[model samples]
Target: MKLLFIGSRLYDDIDWYVKRKNIESILTESNENAINLDLPDQVFIVPRGMDGPKQVAVMQNVDAIVPLIGIDPPLIDVAHMKEEIEQEHGIPVIAANVRAVELTSNKIKTKKFYDEIGVVTPEYQILDSPDDLTLEFPVVLKQGEGQGGKDIKIAKSMDDVEEYFKNFNQALCEQFIEGSEISIEVLGFNGEFVALPPIYKGETTLEGTHPLSKVKTGPCMVQGLDNNLVQHTAYKVAKNLDSDGIFEMDFMYSPEKDQLYAIEVNTRPNGTRYLTTATCGVNSLCELVNMAIGEFSPANISDKLEYHYSTEIPVGDYNGPCPNEPVKSFDDNDFVVHGPEGYQRLTARADSKKDLDNLISKLL
Candidate 1:
């Protein structure tokens, strides 16, 4: 089967799988100098919208399309293109649908969606001005849209709120929950959804720490919160989304209050995939290819699941043992190092916790 993949930034992450499947790979990039342009069989340097990729997909007569966009801005256009192309041309687009993107792309709308689905999320109030604030201090001030903790602040006083308002007229203010932060990845195709193991992303701080800066481990071992509960809750959210491809959800579990609160969801490839794949042998990105090839199902995923203790640590640079060709993949190695030069992270796994500790100590 031939496939058209959008974006070259994340193409390297799954390039090994695409080549292994022997599917003709076509990639598109807006910038001519993007990194992974050479990995695909054919490369098209298209403009900055879905129109270019849509045109390329149709012209190439590809069987399916898989978007490797790892950011939030282009999802709506991809969703729009998915609707039009899938309906008219009968070619599947392996990504979230329009309704799912609309519900998840906005923070306020996501909170309301959680409420409608009976999932617990933090109490929030949309603020037009600092004077309208009702929640106590130390609240999370966020815009309606952002990722990687962008444009987010933890306010301790009215001054903080006022300072935040200078940039935007409105804010989606949420009561900050102090507890362990968890990230779970769920894959959905043909109405079958499976939540992979949850990753422990450290604790929330009064300073509003972003998960990207913290040390993380897979198959979370929180004291009071159960991993099954995290998985079940994630599965519920993905089912409600009623979309395809990957859904990465962030959640916070407060030991003080003994409560679990859903934070937000990213309906695309995310940063948590490496650790998730290390812990359980299921790769969400590879599963997107599976969906395109008509090989995605609960049975296929269940058979691929493997238990391993894994941890991801941020480092300055990597100078240790490396995996084969696609060094970032977990296919034949217990560890994979990724990210840009200065901010690289090494993710490794083992059969037991002690073994995992030994592996990380030796590697780092």
Candidate 2:
């Protein structure tokens, strides 16, 4: 089978699996200098947007298009392309549909979706001005769209809300739940969905620090919160969205209130993949390949499940030791190192928690 993968940013994560399956790999990138271009069997430097990929897929007669875009800005365009390509061209696009993207791309819409689906999310209001604020202080102020903590602030007072409004006219302000931050990656394909183990991304702070900057651990050892509950809720969200590919959902567990609140969902490959794979042997990136090749099913995923203790630490400018070939894979190595210079992170796993602790100390 031949697959046309859009964006080379995440191709490396699944290159080994593609080679093992002997699937012809083709990739298209907006920039010629993008990383992981060497991993694909063929590469096409195309103009930005979904038009270039659509034309390339038709010209090449590729069997399917698996969009590997890791960011949010291009998802809406990709969703439109998915609709047109699958309907007009009769070629499958392994990604979220337009309806799913529209509901998830906007934070306000996602909040309403949770309410409609009976999933618990924090109480929030769309505030146009500081005077319109009804929620108490220490609220999380945010725009309708953003990722990785962009355009987000924890407002503590009217002055904070006013300061936030100076930059943006409207904000989706939520009653801040000061508690443990958790993320789960759910894989959905052909009307089937599976939620992997949860990752414990430290507590929410008054400063609104994102999980990206904090150290994260696997299997979510948060007291008073069950991982099964997280998995079930994530599965519900994915079933409601009813889309393909990956659904990375973020949630906050309040120990004080004993409540679990859904925060956000990204209908694409996300930062949580590495830790999720480290904790559980199922790689969502590889599963995207499975989805494209008609090898995806609940039984197939259940067979690949393996539990291990894992942790990811933000080790800027890693001067530590390196692993063998297939650096992204945890097959031989106990860890994987990733990210750009001065902000790289090291993720490692072991059979037991005690062994994981020792491995991390020695790696550091």
- The prediction achieving the highest lDDT against the true structure is 1
lDDT of 2 by residue, 253-272 (tens): 99999999999999989897
Work out the TM-score per prediction.
Answer: 0.98, 0.98
What's the lDDT for all of these models? 0.93, 0.92
**Which regions of candidate 2 fall more than 4 Å away from where they truly are?**
none
| Number of backbone-clashing residue pairs for each candidate, in the order shown | 0, 0
Error of 1 at 275 (Å): 0.3
> In model 1, what are the clashing residue pairs, if there are any?
none
Candidate 2 local distance difference test against the native: 0.92
